[model samples]
Target: MAGSLGPGSGWTAAVRRLLRQFSSAQRPGSPGFQGLPLLVEGQQVGLVVPAVARELRAFPNVFVEVTGGLELRGGHCPEERTEAVAGVLAQLRAEGRLARLARWRDEAYEVRPSFGAPALLNVERAAAPLLGVLQFGAHLNAFVCRQDDETGSWQIFMWLARRSPHKATYPGLLDNLAAGGISAGLGVKETMVKESWEEARVPPKLAAQAQPVGCLSFTYEEMDGEEFGAVVRECLFIFDLEVPEDFTPQVGDGEAQEFYLWPLNKVREAVNSGSFKPNCALVVVDFLFRHGLLHPDHEPLYPELMAVMHQTL
Candidate 1:
């Protein structure tokens, strides 16, 4: 597939831009004060400033004492703090303070001090608007891709899932075969398997065969509401699964509308056509590179693109 796609193609540029935006080396040059310090167990996690954080401080469910930075304490343990924040977000949703933001999964994800190892605390996925403002390192994405060599020419096809129209964010967008956030109390592989079953109806046996490819990290400022917004720092754990040629993915959950198996050219077209979610588009580009479907000589900026994509989080 090397040199099959010409350099300077619009899709190639789009893919390159996606890779650059998500890389830490291309960090946004913003004033430091835009984000508030997020502290868990007295340690800094991220910076957030969603209105919900102010509400969190005002709510009595969780102890919010501000000594140097905003801290989630007064709860006996991390669970307590998590419960307190979830409750607060739920109430805000009910009161209409948070509208579409509430449509995210209700599950909680573990927020770590940095990348891996020890976890600091857990928070609701929807409440990420609040935490995202703090730029907490809790947000994570697990992407599952299926590789098919049915063409018998060593050609590859990837299975893609279309998001449900009812989804709050990126509704009806194309996504990976199975993708989800790494919820609190769930490991990367665990979340991948769970999402695989829920989103693609993949049998546990099949899901278990998935292998971790690598991780992509990026931080972007996002507006959660008209009045509230936060800088979001996220890491996506990418995985690849080799599947039988005849295998088809069914939607077990309402999260996705349907699944489609697309060839490399079609995948590239869909990604550059703006049919896929921004993050998913990036994942697809990474997929192309890892699978050797996209070659270094295909693009003039190949070296720069690969360098940014391969940078360690």
Candidate 2:
């Protein structure tokens, strides 16, 4: 049946559409286009939109408008840069200049020119979009496999979590079993384990069994509201964990309200219906591709989809 995916397959269309939304920010002259390259230590580390740039201009000593773009004042080391930026962010928050900063988690995300580069500075997680800095996160796909007694075929079931309604973003949307942003001092695997335990009650021993898969990257622009024009450049590290069939995920930290174990087809349907949070849906799609549920022969845009998921941002 997996071989039947070919031209005109409806299943692949939804996945294609979702991927397009994430890639929209990359389009030439798209709305809320990154206003200027944000440079730190002579290297482009992020982007600054005009609104953010205007607010930044007020802090002349900390932020300077250079020939090509915006740059942090010179002679400041990474620690100094972080302190200067924190002061500016705190002032802005106090004055209510940037509305998004109100959601501050008091958590810091390291700013780097690239994924593995040394930290240029550390910024509040909520302010990442405003700065257009690349953010990193870890997502775990927890699943269990069972054999059909009669058909002798293996079926995979994934655990999906429904976000708590009171959440600040994507409230009540379906999400991966457990996921979280990598805080300034934590490693990728450590964050994954912490989030799994905090959000889904997944024991550390079991979470440690998760195997590291590849990653997905995308640049997304806020379309409207207070954060309009703010960009989110993110890379999510994906992990696959096979849980025992009897294991049931419990609500650990109130982030997730409930958990459901559904077959791959049902999960795909939710993705098509847009029930899953946008980024979580992408993670699930990557999982399906890796597990052989999605094939190139059936999906015409297979190559493009694969490429877009790993955009060189």
Candidate 3:
């Protein structure tokens, strides 16, 4: 979710407005670097820069070589570049410059020059908190939805999780039933299966039944103290898991406080009312449209909304 907080009304109306706004637009406003160059050995290999890291250019040690965009130079190869960047981040952390940054995990995410290709380098996930801030590449999202048959027929209901207050990012906000970043070592399905258990406590037999339902790609910028103007270029690997009617999600690892089974109408109300995290709302919109709940006759911006949902990163 980007730059949304508190509560608002007109859930459905808000959805319409967002559809019209994002679909009609191509890029975010000038807040942070659109695509900062990630240079290695004076050659442009990739892109990565914070949307709003105030001291990006004032690093005391790591050299900033500017050409067309903010360039990180000095490392002889990709691995060397990564070490150099990590060193800078370690220094920042030591100086208390990353209070708002997520807890340092010493984990690395692969930075690719393009989609579905070999990575140019591996960078600390904390350094490029925003997906495209360092323009590393794609982060995966898993959206969990279920079928509601309480009305006698198979109707749709969403299982939404309330993020734990302890979370460093978007704590206590609404989130998908089971979601996480696709870490460097995990494959897509492996990630989905792991999160299903770790976040929602879905049993293996039930989790194995989960199905892939395509993906939603989008880029968003947020205004926050830690990551101002951060751009997230993400591809959500949406999944649909039909749990037994009586199943209730229990918090497995404290990522979520609890889970709620929401009727489709209530889901719509929450979305319009801004009760859901911003990006989660986008996932819900795609689910609704895919299930034929959002139609052209009712939503004048239906086509545009769909277009934005499937935009190429």
Put the candidates in lDDT order, highest first: 2, 1, 3
Against the reference, the lDDT scores of all candidates come to 0.67, 0.87, 0.63
Clashes of 2: 1
Pick by TM-score: 1 or 3, better one: 1
In angstroms, give how far residue 213 of model 3 lies from its true place: 1.3
Each candidate structure's TM-score, on Cα atoms with residue i matched to residue i, is 0.81, 0.93, 0.79
Candidate 2 per-residue lDDT over residues 92-208, each given as its tens digit: 999988888888899999999998899989999999999889999999999998888888777888999999999989999999999999999899999999999999999999999
What digit string (tens of lDDT, one per residue) describes model 3 on residues 1-313?
1111223356447867666544432253445435565454454444444443236566624557465555565376778866877776777678876553556767677666445766656766655543253232211223334434564445566788898998877788888888766667677777777888898888767776777788877655444474543445666777777677778889999989998887677777877877776777787887777677776666665676777777765
Residue 163 of candidate 3: its Cα lDDT?
Answer: 87
Per-residue lDDT tens digits for candidate 1, residues 1-313, read 3225454346765766576565422232444444566777767776666364666677754636475457766466766766676677777778877654557576667766776547666776666645752222211122324434664344566788889998888999998888887766667788888888888888878888888888766666556557676556667788888787678889888999998887667778887778988877877877777767667666666776666554432
Please give the lDDT score for candidate 1.
0.67
**Residue 23 in candidate 3, Cα distance off native in Å:** 7.5
**Model 3 regions more than 4 Å off:** 1-9, 16-35, 40-66, 98-103, 130-153, 226-228
Best by lDDT: 2
